[model samples]
Target chain A: MANVRIERLHKEFRGAGGIVHALADLTLDIADGEFISLVGPSGCGKTTALRIIAGLETPTSGRILFDGRDITRLEPRDRNIAMVFQSYALYPHMTVRQNLEYGLRKRGAPRDERARKVAAIAAMLRIEPMLDRRPLQLSGGQRQRVALGRALIRDPEVFLLDEPLSNLDAKLRVHMRAELAALHQKVRTTMVYVTHDQLEAMTLSDRIVVMNHGVMQQVGRPEEIYSRPANRFVAEFIGTPSMNMIEGQVRTEAGRPLFTGPGITVVLPRDAPQALPSSGRATLGIRPEHVSLVAPDAPGAIPARVTVSELAGPERFHFVAVEGGSIIVRTPAATVLHPGETVALGFDPDRLHLFDGTGEDAPALR
Target chain B: MPPRNAARLYPLVLLLLAFVAFPLYWMASTSLKPQTEVFRVPPTFVPETWTLRHYVELFWLTDFGLLFVNSLKVCLVSTGLALVVGSLGAYALARFRVRGKEAYGRLVLLAYMFPGALLVIPLLLLFRQLGLTNSHLGLSLAYLTFAVPFVMWVMRDFFASVPVDLEEAALIDGASRLGALWDVVLPQAVPGLIATGIFAFLFAWNEYLFALILISDESLRTLPPGMMRFVSTTDTNWGLIMAASTLATLPMALAFGLIQRYLVTGLGAGGVKG
Candidate 1:
């Protein structure tokens, strides 16, 4: 096992029209035996970062250190990393046993040792019956298992998985996610996983690195990033149904800061500091699950019209028309609210997030 | 309901059958006819007397055996050389992002498109200056100008159909690029190699122009030019010529019959999207 360190990595492709920046000054440290998931939107350099770590691609300028040794120019085989591609990439002409044995044979391992390792991995992955079958005869799930088995049989210093479950059906993806987590636990190797699915990042990662446009936005545990997002992008990206953001001005009303917009007004917490710039522009961020519908006579309530209601399992999401744009609130499915109905939407002042005019500023809880 | 479609196809099928079967039947019938009834004007479809005189004459009275052996040697050598060089070049073109890769590919196609008839005289001159005329080596070199390009272009297209991921998987498994190609990629390309080999073989075997120009010795002549030797200023022996023609075509017919299944499967695999 080895710890992989990347410092100030940058990659650019010279295309016909102009230079396309794939990765820009990325710095990350992956500890030995830790699973790190790099999550981002498409074209956000997640795969490029993984490829650089695997030594399959070269960074335009940077340093990659493995176990305190510089290895930026090493070949993929010399890097001692096994990568499982998104397509499974199984050798169609070879049987499962041969596929698993190929890496060992190339490494010049002894025959008995190679056979022993193959048998152990096949038993661990429960793929013993598939050992004699070619890739085409296997189903999608079986192919994925064989791909994982092929990587595991090598027993390399690091395991790199690039969206290995993206090709499976939805149900199989869930099942394989758990299986992968179990496999990682059993092996305890340094793993660098890349995926665009946020749930996969949350479920499988010891630490999740959220990136956007070739830049790392935040890195932390799932719950820490969910509760304390570094900026508006993380706040808007990590949650389901996304966070409702409303732009307004921050003004003092009777010595207490109050956010006032066109069709809505809300009182801020009394002890909240007035540290925001006097740009008179800020955005209020609140998750849909944080907003609640209450009786009209209740204290600290804002009146709004219900635009639509969608039943999602036991919870119903109500799209309420408030000042600037719509705010979604999750209520009980038993709630009898309909379109065009007037209701009082209640939310705690402490749960509100206040940000400056620019979306990049750190969010301050009100 | 479909009687009209069947009726429409009958004449087309009949025309195809007649066009294909007529020459074969005539060759076979004439090979058995006596030398006297060969041009009986009425053209007997069946001979009154069958004879093995032509076959006997061809082996003993002529150098047909030597010509057959010469053709086989030249065709086999040329086909083998073409396959080895073409497969190596094609694999490089298929996988490597070398400088001027597209130019190299277009150059291969251009070589194939070049007219062989125009190059014959210059090639003869070059071969004569090098003391290569009337040599098997000269004929093989001339044949490669056409055969290599055909083999390379077809094999390049064949290799392109195989997924790069398969080779990458092998590379990750500790194989070098060439090793991966030999172990994984070439196994999938067996059918293609066979098909390309057959084409190269046929191209060299049936060539008449260069063989006529290069080989002055009757013993060194290939099947096509050797068959033409039966014609002289005084008379054209139709019976002997037909027998020799039938003899010359036997190898090609057997070869095609042997590899037709593999040719179809190989071409179909390369043609289909992976």
Candidate 2:
């Protein structure tokens, strides 16, 4: 397996109206045997970047290097990468055995070698009984397995999966995600996976590349991306139920600094910046799990009116309105709170994030 | 009790059956009638006396056998050429981003929509200039204008229904574009190919206007125009005419019967959204 390096890659499509810059100056380094996921909202060019790596698409600028050799102009076959599509694009007319052997046959492998590889892959995928069946006869999950088997038989330098598990049902998707993780561990190939599902990105990837608006936001371990987001967009986009963002002004209070919004005020951590931006506007971000509900008389708590309470299994999510904005708090399912009731919302100072007045400005407080 | 949906459909089904089966039954019965009873004051629903004399006379006196062979040869050649050229063009239009591809696709459909009669005169002159008049090869070439457009249009839609991902997967497997189409796409398109072939064959087989204008040699005449020669100035042998018509329709009937299953499957698959 070889490591792949993408340097300042850009892709633009010229449509009837104007040029759509699908990918802009994307540079990433995928180490050998690394499982990296490109995750983002739809139309963010994550798939386009993967396609460019696979040689299915050409970049408008920049270069891609595989194992220290430039391969930007190579054909997909010459690139030696195997890609699994979201649709599990199996040849409908060919039996499973033929499908698995397609790549080997195309490369002019010996008949015995092709047969041996087909049998081995079929056994690994547990598709021996299905070797004679056409794709139309297989279930969605089965087709996906066959699609994976087809790619595996190629023994390529990198495994590129474009939302391979997205077509399966929920339970099957979870099963296949774990199976894919195990498969990657077994094969130890340099794999680049693309998906819009954050859970998949978090669970399966060794490193996750988060993107937005055709721009890479951050590439880091899942926890780093979730806990220490590079910007406000990354913070809001990576978490379930999303992080609560409150617009406020950062100002000095007494000896320490504090954040002041329309109807609430909270002191920042002691290490935080005392001098704020001249505009005196900032935004505070806190995850739902970081917030808590406490007794009205609890110390260092903000008083707020609870707007909605939803029971999600063993956890409860409380939407509390403190000032001009609302924050969600995950509490014990037994912690009962009614709508319109005044409650104390407590959170750790360390978990609070403060950004500059203009959201686009540098983050003023961490 | 509520009225059943089947009960509601009974009269419409009966009407459709009558509309379809009546002409076929009339044709068959007329073919079996003796010449004297064929035009009786009240047309006989069934012949009073069955005879094979008209069938015997057609093979013995007319050039029916030669015409049958000629029609078969021309239809097969034209259909084969149309399927090959049209399928390649369709695949290209469906898969490639050639310059003016959309325009080319539109032009093929427009050609198919234009009436064949309008081109017959120009085509006749062109055939003469090219030394193709009265030749089977010329007739086959003339049929291409109609058949190729038809095959191309239907096959274009057929190829479009096939997922591009399958071909891409083949490409990743080291198959060239042509190899992938031949090995993967064409197999899945078997029913479509058959349907388009049948359409081209029937178009050439049943065509009368072009054959009449282009071919004057009795040996090169197809079944339709050759049957017209049986009509005399004073008397028309109705039995012989019906026999020849029946004989001419047999091949079409047998062909449709053999491929009806594939035709249905093809139409269903080709028309469905990918």
- State the lDDT of candidate 2 residue by residue for A252-277, as single tens digits: 87888878877767888898865677
lDDT of 2 by residue, B1-274 (tens): 3569889988999999999978877777888888888889888897899988889888998888999999999999899999999999999988887889999999999998889899999999999999999999899999999899888888888998888888888888888778889988998899999989998998898899999999999889988788888888998888898898888888888989999999998878877855
* Residue A352 lDDT, candidate 1, scale 0-100: 79
TM-score of each: 0.89, 0.93
Which regions of candidate 1 are displaced past 4 Å? Answer: A250-262, A267-280, A297-300, A332-337, A348-351, A354-366, B1-14, B17-21, B44-53, B125-134, B214-220, B269-272
Instruction: Tell me the whole-model lDDT of each prediction, alpha carbons only.
Output: 0.86, 0.88
Query: What is the C-alpha lDDT profile of model 1 across A276-307, one tens digit per residue?
Result: 54777888788888898889888767788999
Q: Per-residue lDDT tens digits of candidate 1, residues B16-119?
A: 99999899889978987989988789889888889978888888888888889999999999999999899999989987768889999999999999998988
Residue B223 of model 2 has an lDDT of: 82
Clashing pairs in 1: none
Which candidate achieves the best TM-score against the true structure? 2
